[model samples]
Target: MKEYHVTVRRSAPEGGEGYLQEYTVPFPDDEIVSVLNVLEYIYRELDPTLAFFDHAACRQAACGKCMVKVDGAVKLACKEPAHETMLLEPYSTRVVRDLLCES
Candidate 1:
């Protein structure tokens, strides 16, 4: 299996300066990988403390809870295709933590 390099904007919900945290995730080239899947991999296999809006997310791109900035473009994580390298950030300035934001 190959890998995907991801840089995610992380922050404390309490309030403080946010910073980018990089992680390399396992990515199989034979299948389609979504941005949300990357986040799930990080949280499950890499870092459990990572905060993201996968809870109750539609995963079909119907519910927009999983919205984030993928390489500076606002997109639904469930629908956005993951590339080899990606920069993930909160879609809004009011970030809750990591790629999570106030909706």
Candidate 2:
């Protein structure tokens, strides 16, 4: 099994402070995984408090609700590939918590 590093920007709800946290997750190197998948893994297996937004339309990037910053580039989380090392951050709008941006 191969492991990857992900640095996530986290923020508290209601105009609280923000910070960056890092995590190590295992993934199949030969297979392609989306950034949302990695976030799900972290939320499910590592930290339940991790917050993010996703909807049914996220499968095709039609909703635009799962938008986040990957290495300083804004993209739909479901459409961005989870790389060996990624820097994940919420949009510059209003961060509700973790990777969630206020709609």
Candidate 3:
């Protein structure tokens, strides 16, 4: 497995200013994986303090729960493949907590 960096922004659960936190991920294969999976991976293996309530498998890009700013571009977390060095931030709205913004 290869290591990857996943950086999530810091914020509050309700709303607040955001910052960044980086995590290391191990990708066993080059195959693409959703950002939600990456987040889960980080939560499980890296940090648990990071807060987020994600509902993946809706597969519907409309839900917006998986919405996040990746490298400064707004994209659905479940829709984008986890990059090697990903920088995650809240979506353009209220801040929820590192990587999770108000939808």
Candidate 4:
């Protein structure tokens, strides 16, 4: 099966040190899947510890709650298409934990 290699910048709570963690998500080579979809799959099937602001988020790009840095460029996770290899990160240094940051 094809897959997408996603590297996420992770951190714990209370000013914890940050690190980079990579996850491989099963994906179709020609399919246009959103980055948020990969994250959901990881959270549901792989790691429950991964964090992001996806709760009650509007997936239509209308709501900017899923904003994050995709390969160094900030984009809406819900709207941005997934790539074969990508890096996911918070939009700013004020990350609460994982991909979530202070709004």
Candidate 5:
């Protein structure tokens, strides 16, 4: 198994203060996981309070709703690979909470 460091920018709900939180996620060395999978793992297995917008049925990038900033670059979370180390933030907009953007 291999572990990855993921730094996530989180914000409180309804225009509250924001901060950065980091988590170490593990994955099989021979398996590739998407960024969305890592997020789901974090939410399901690590933190239940984490909030973000995702439509699991539409994870193929057909919809533009799952947009987020990964390493300062805007990307569809479902379509990007979960790299060894990642810096994640919500899209530049009014953040509802954590990675959930108001746009």
Candidate 6:
């Protein structure tokens, strides 16, 4: 099972509760992948206790809700395959959660 580390910067559910958390996940194959899928896997199997929420739709690289920074450059999470170690962070527009930048 191939795996990678993802650092997510998510906002706290309440006041002054924002921080970065590292998540280790496994990728089966080099199939079409989305940032939200990775996040969902982590939230479902890896750690279900982490408090992070995201909004994603039309995994066809159209909707910008899944836009994030992978190792620095901003790209659509839904467009990029989750196939490597990535530093996922919020965009420059808004701070909703890890790797979720508003535009």
lDDT of 3 by residue, 1-103 (tens): 8777887778745555456677888877865777777888888877888776577557557776777877889888778877888888777666545666565
| Candidates 3 and 5, the one with greater lDDT | 5
Name the 10 consecutive residues with the lowest summed lDDT in model 3.
12-21
Once fitted onto the true fold, the runs of candidate 4 whose alpha carbons sit more than 4 angstroms away are none
Task: Give all TM-scores, in the order shown.
Answer: 0.91, 0.88, 0.80, 0.90, 0.91, 0.72
| 1-103 per-residue lDDT for model 5 (tens digits) | 9898999999855556788999999999998788888899899999988887789789998988888899999899899999899999998777778998887
Candidate 5, lDDT over the whole model: 0.88
Ranking by lDDT: 4, 5, 1, 2, 3, 6
Q: Ten residues in a row with the worst lDDT in model 4? A: 10-19
Give every collision pair in model 6.
9-98, 91-101
lDDT of each: 0.87, 0.85, 0.74, 0.88, 0.88, 0.68
Residues 3-97 of candidate 2 have per-residue lDDT tens digits of: 87999988755566777899999987777888888888999999999999868545678887888899999988889888789999987767777
Return the clash pairs for model 4, or none.
none
Residue 20 displacement (Å), model 2: 1.2
TM-score of 2: 0.88
**Model 5, residue pairs in steric clash:** none
Model 1 scores a C-alpha lDDT of: 0.87
| Candidate 1: tens digits of C-alpha lDDT, residues 18-100 | 77899999976787999988999998898999988985536998887888999999999999999799999889988777777
